[model samples]
Target: MPKDALISTQSRHRMTTRIWHWSNALCLLILLMSGLTIFNAHPRLYWGEYGANDDHAWMAVGSSQTMGYLRLGELRIETTGALGNWQDSQGRTQTWAFPGWATIPSHYSLADGRRWHFFFAWIFSVGLALFMVMSLWNRHIQRDLHMRRDQWRPSHIWRSFRAHLDLRVIRQTAGEDYNSIQKMSYIGVIFLLLPLMIFSGLAMSPAMDANWPFLTDLFGGRQSARSLHFIGAFLLLLFFLVHMVMVLLSGPFRQTRSMITGGEGKEPLA
Candidate 1:
């Protein structure tokens, strides 16, 4: 890429978008860490209305008399040292849903975990709502994130998929915008995944159920909502991982600078 070409490129991320992006990133990290800490209280998942120690769980992480295990439905796998059973700082045996390193507070404190989770949950929810409204008002969603009719074509989608596999990122000069795959991903995250995560999180709240029983009904049950919430979190984590990989592969410094300062750098080589 020539110096002139780099200089010619314009802003890739708007100020509001960049603000929301960073804010959301921070909120998500807090939420996920606190959430895992909360999950350590149960370390098991069940379907339908109710579940307890006596009740059958669809998934569980626990240590037996002999070894640690992760039970998924009927299948059980020994996951000692990694998941089910691990030694603590004092050399005490500990069993938790997620490892201590994976959670906030890094120890058993359901109260503290809940407090952190709810505080950030409010921020995440309100921030997301404001961002969406602003995006709509500014036509950011319509002009940049929305998929065009041509993008819906099978051939176009296949081409985009192939390009992604080839790590080919189509560089925009000035007026051009995100590619079809980028548009679809942004749309899915903004409209579908994030909302689902919020709703599922709300559904798990006993207060939410008391005020709006419909949420529990909507998701079939509280336990079902909890399961969905976990699934959504896992999916979001996967998205984050993929996003980071794409950023590194595309152009770490250039892409990061564009987000931070809204100035483009040299195009990344395919």
Candidate 2:
């Protein structure tokens, strides 16, 4: 139906790319769930050098005897079943910001959550570092992700965004070279957001803070770094959700098969 759909399916994902894709996916899943467990320990966010129970929080998820709510500055909204308060698996009422099913241990245990978070965190960090080096060595970054001068123009970007919104481009290109918008999103996730998530996490560590004060200072403070880390994780989650939808919408079987086997269905174009 479309020109690119009829184009060659000769393009194959490299082994490193395929491995990194799935490994990164698993790492993010564990990190996010466990991170939620850790967040339930505080359930509040603040800016600047220090924050405490007595101090003002820019955002907080809390509950009263009768209600669970999310407070954002001066605004408050009830979130009884999902945030601030929810029932446990056994139907016992709990007052955690996130539900048990969404967290790692499915129970309140900051210690255990931290253990799970840190263990997978190392895997995520190491896997990301290796992916980057391999990507560079293979020139995958330069050849595949690099955008042409015309693709950077406002008109070109707008068209690409519109195509993504309508699912036109992805359905056509599928396993072919990524469109401009796709490349930019991948670039941001790979080079910027992932690194920020890692370094800001390190900035929140007490040992890193004491040994490398500059890391903490770079992000303003431990609390600020924590805030940034949460934000970065949120952005990553957003990307993952949208990426999944795109893959499923375009053709999940074809895409998944390519990533797993590192080969396309068709040998060459018509």
Candidate 3:
């Protein structure tokens, strides 16, 4: 190999980080996919009409959820079960020890939808917890991805951005494991989007509704929570799109190998 083409192949990351990174990535993919499939079933948008839809109103006035327009054919199989006390369309609240006559929408295989969503969600949550714990424990996040004061400099950021746009920035920047773009994207996806997806999901869960009344308060209502969940999934999908483009631009094999085994080559001799 030529001097400039030294094929450095070594890993600096711990085994656990490598494992969780890919595992979380997979879980995130499934969560986003299935979540999107389900969301597509009910593309309808609704806002809590304070006066007219008062009794069934989900969120307080001024609070809003932007529900997306989903494509058809994502409906799950139809199934029904008893639901506890719930308000009816007439603005009269009724205690239904058994579910009332209501048409519940299923956007995919209802049974499969429930099963896959619940199961995959647990994996997603665990992966997130593990990643977060590992990041803090090793201080890896603080050291590697966090923005230092100097990084905020306009010249530094502009240089980093240009390099990232070309996928050549990482190669040129010294001691910069992640370019500014990478840092911003990873931080936004992992910290903001991931948590938003998880919390919004839980906020929509029936089981959680019983225990955490405030969940409804936080996200507006169950349906509103569902709306937020859809938005969060969309954000994850957006992240995945950019991530794939980056991987492609940067060389999938190179990027995948580095993520799996850490970047090649040990530190140079002093």
Best by lDDT: 2
Supply the TM-score for candidate 3.
0.68
Q: What would you estimate as the lDDT of candidate 1?
A: 0.82
User: What TM-score does prediction 1 earn?
Assistant: 0.89
Q: TM-score of model 2 relative to the true fold? A: 0.92
| CA shift of 177, model 3, Å | 1.6
Candidate 3 lDDT over residue span 137-199, tens digit each: 766577567887878788998887777666465444433366666778888887988888888
What ranges in model 3 sit over 4 Å off? 1-12, 47-107, 170-176, 265-270
Candidate 2 stretches with Cα past 4 Å from truth are 1-11, 265-270
Write candidate 1's Cα lDDT for 110-168 as tens digits.
Answer: 99999999999999999999999988876678767878899999899888877777644
TM-score of each: 0.89, 0.92, 0.68
lDDT of 2: 0.87
lDDT of 2 at 106: 92
lDDT (Cα atoms) of all candidates against the true structure? 0.82, 0.87, 0.59
In Å, residue 223's CA in model 1 sits off its true spot by: 0.4
RMSD each, Å: 4.9, 4.2, 11.6
